[model samples]
Target: MATSSICRRRSLSPRRHLTTSPASFILLPLFSKKRTMWCYQNDRCKDNFKKSFRLLKGCASERLSALVVVLLLAIVSYTLYEVQYKTGIEIVPFLPIDDSGFETYNEKLLNDVVTSKAAQNQLPRGSLMCWVMTTSIYHKTRVNAVNSTWLPRCDSSHILTNSPRFLDDQIPYHTVFNSLPESYYKLFWKTRLALLYVYQNVSSEFDWYFKADDDTYVIVDNLRKYLARFDPEKPYFIGYRLKRRMPNNGYNAGGSGYAMSRAAMRIFAEKLFHDKSLCPYHEWEDYAIARCLASMNIYPLDSRDELGRQRFLPWRPEQHFHADLTPSFLMDPIQFWGPSIFHENLVSMHHLKPDEMRLIDGLLYGVSQGIWKPQKAPNSSTSLVNSTEASPMEDTIQPPTVSF
Candidate 1:
């Protein structure tokens, strides 16, 4: 048993010897060196990778910042360019030359008076002529004549026509004319007043009613011919438009040569009677007229050449229409008075001198086919009709008389 025990111990001792030997220890040391080298290399590589990632992140941030800045600047620059493109051009104003008060015989009143007297003198056979005067009054005789023969005379007594209650409070600059309460109102009143007169009285007159200002010349034959062109069944307003810059909401600051239409009269009357509140006071006459028509869905036709201008004449043989007429004294010396000058057939003319009646009458009779020479002035021997007082003709010459 001792021998068997000794053999077992020997076996265990050999195993132990193998485990504790210097050669084995040296091999273990070599394995430890290899592991340390691998660990060191791994640590260095990890550090380098972390450094590279940090660099890449910084570069991306900088690039993004620069791109954002460029975009912001571009957006700001584009907004300023559009603001400077809208406020450059403007419109002109219409300022009448003769805006004086009438102390003596208002030509407008005289015309009405004479028309009434002539109508009465000729009794059921004479034609009645009506005239409209802006910024002036007429004689009593003329007023009577207008009442008796011309139908109605419309005058704005410098009274301002106010906007409706709801509109007045809502509109901007409503109280701007407090000092001259009616000043702003007068601008629109003259035109509207005339329109009202026509609406109430002259819807159906002898044959036709001519609309013109004191400073205009009306060629009766030419007007007759022009009137003939329009079918009374489908009446249209006729006039010359003052070419102005568009997109302007303000007044059309110029003369509207003249407009005539049976439909215009009735339509305007209906509109005014029905929706008087819709009519706003405007300083521009033409614009007001346009507004009145627009309310009724009636627009002007593009017939511009019917009226004559200082630069161009009408194409028709008998010069029947003209605008912007000035007195000979106010005109340039180089200008010439042609056959179309105010005469017997003159529907209207502007700026005639008080003493020029003789000259005007002579011209009228002289141009007659047999009365006198076309160039000859009339003789004083002819019976002269003076409409100075409140004669029956005076009533006829009141405001609203049709003049052309």
Candidate 2:
């Protein structure tokens, strides 16, 4: 009975909850709150660090991508430059712009010309006139050579000289102009007079006028081909252009010969000849014409070959034309007075003796008929020629100024 009472007493004594110790009950809640706060702060710091890392990674990625793009662009540009250097073809010459801010030769114009030429079978032969500048004494041989060779290629041809002669069908120019003594100094006057006479007398018959010296050898077929690209109605002057020691807008080297459109000729006749005081009378007819044309704003066209070589050659085969290059044919005693590289398409050669003219006449005729092969000269190397040098392809060429 005493034990039972003690057990009941013990059971009833702590009817108190035994879930926690006394010390835990006092400090556990506070410790739990402190741990939770520390965990929350640690989690916030981790999130902030992760966000910062992600932003830094994104910035690095963008910078790397931009760097990669710049590198690729640089590589591509270098590759193109290398390719252009390796290939000999130049799409654009060194100096593409002229002093006047116009493109000297544009790809667009070339394309247009080529496209237009695809359909035309041949340039109209009736539209051309060839004028041979000759004296009375040498007409028999030189005139005969032209007649036998290239003169027949034109629609009409005339000899311009101031000489009285017994009228022969072969030599009609004797009666063409009143007798002016055949002097070198009087050439400019004769040329002026000839231009005036032709303009007044027979301008209605032709659309294009070609002027050549007696010693000049011309490929009329090639000339016609060249002329086909331009319209006769436009004021175009085509020739071997000379910038050095020329008038304000450049002039044609007369030894190589020159061609002027009907419109250009009309301007010369109407405006240039009438004003005797416009330019001083000089011995060089070609320079005088250039000065006269410059005043009227008619500039010379650059008439180079497909290879960018001058079609009209002024120098003989033995002479040096530029500082770096000499013009010559490979064959000893050159039949053609041009660099052998351009022999196949030789336009005009200067200083052709009357006999040599006859020989070339036969050779050129044979080539035209495909019966003869044009033999290349053995040592005639065209390595030194850079069309960009001394050509209209340069930047700021010597401005054209009149020379006596």
Candidate 3:
């Protein structure tokens, strides 16, 4: 059996039980991560397919039976050939790619949703356009709760789904007419495509961009005030920082949500999107976006309060506040449960039920108590608060001195 140890570092309150980076860390789940498991991806199953084919052939040697058997075998062989020989085509069963040789929705109609409206003209100075990644299944459930609760507070918000029927519902959704199937693993693609669309169409409208999930409950006013000190002109990526395979820095955790400056959004759309090596596909949505941002020298910044209490939490209030917690093997291993106390200026939290979101609305007592607004440090003029290693976005991405 393998051995593991929980090393608690010195801190005031609840501290980490283990010290491991996300790159080499994820462990202890009784079940392993799900595989795409395409039919052609498994070679061992080919023998079973061959056995079945032989039995079916023996069922009848009649001319019609033989013709049907030959047709089926040819189709199978051709599918295998396509998978093995073609590098461009991917047959991910869960996320079906649209190969109709055309875009799904009318581009003009889709762009018209936000193309004409200027966020800067209508909203506050530091306008934030929040994009919530959701699906058709949760269109009515979680999305409705989010819209009814905190989403309205945002300067502008839109639902990102492949479903085009949002037009019929008269909801302000930025639907990309594509055949991308809705699946948990496909979030990376959804996030990337949404940013690209926003950049191409309405980049000039918003000062900052915030992305979240259907279950995420964001204190919009808190987030807007928290990021007010940082110049949106300078690239800022702040959220629940998760240290992944990268050497020095980490990416913001996706569930709790992440905020990016106007500059960061432009850099990602223009520079990172064109380069495959710099912004390649990855399994996790947050990690993939972080990889792209990191290449452009925009890393996740510390979004904690002055006392080092996190502003972004990956779990609900009860999970963090609960005493006598039982350890679990299935829980996400990358959580940074510092001090076990909720910060007064917390901006976001994940894994919330619809009612829980409403419950949080009623309990906004601590939101404005001690907001961490970045200001002139003791002796610094422009240096940001809690950002010892962060710098403004450069003309070109600086290669990290060291990386995985």
lDDT (Cα atoms) of all candidates against the true structure: 0.37, 0.59, 0.63
Q: What is candidate 1's lDDT per residue for 362-385, written digit by digit as tens? A: 344334434431333334455436
User: Model 2 over residues 1-404: C-alpha lDDT tens digits?
Assistant: 34434334434644221112132234445658774345346755456446535544555576688799999988976666554433322335551211120122112222221111211222334688787777657656776676566766777676665453422554435233344455665576667666665555545446788888888888888888788889888888877666544534567878768888888888877777657556435556777777777777888886766555566776563452422232222111223323453555557877887777766776677545554433332233334264323322332232223211
Greater-TM-score candidate between 1 and 3:
3
Off by over 4 Å in 2: 1-125, 164-167, 174-177, 320-344, 367-404
Compared with the true structure, the alpha-carbon lDDT of candidate 2 equals: 0.59
CA shift at 375, candidate 1, in angstroms?
Answer: 17
Q: What TM-score quantifies how close candidate 2 is to the native fold?
A: 0.55
RMSD versus native structure for model 2: 30.1
Off by over 4 Å in 1: 1-129, 134-185, 202-208, 245-257, 273-278, 302-361, 367-370, 373-404
Root-mean-square deviation of each candidate, in angstroms? Answer: 29.0, 30.1, 25.5
Q: In model 3, what is the error at residue 32, expressed in angstroms?
A: 56
Q: Give the candidates in order of TM-score, highest first.
A: 3, 2, 1
Error of 2 at 82 (Å): 54
lDDT of 3 by residue, 285-394 (tens): 78878888988889989787776667877666667665323343112233445455566687998999876876676456223432223332243464566655444433
Q: Could you estimate the TM-score for every candidate? A: 0.39, 0.55, 0.57
Candidate maximizing lDDT: 3
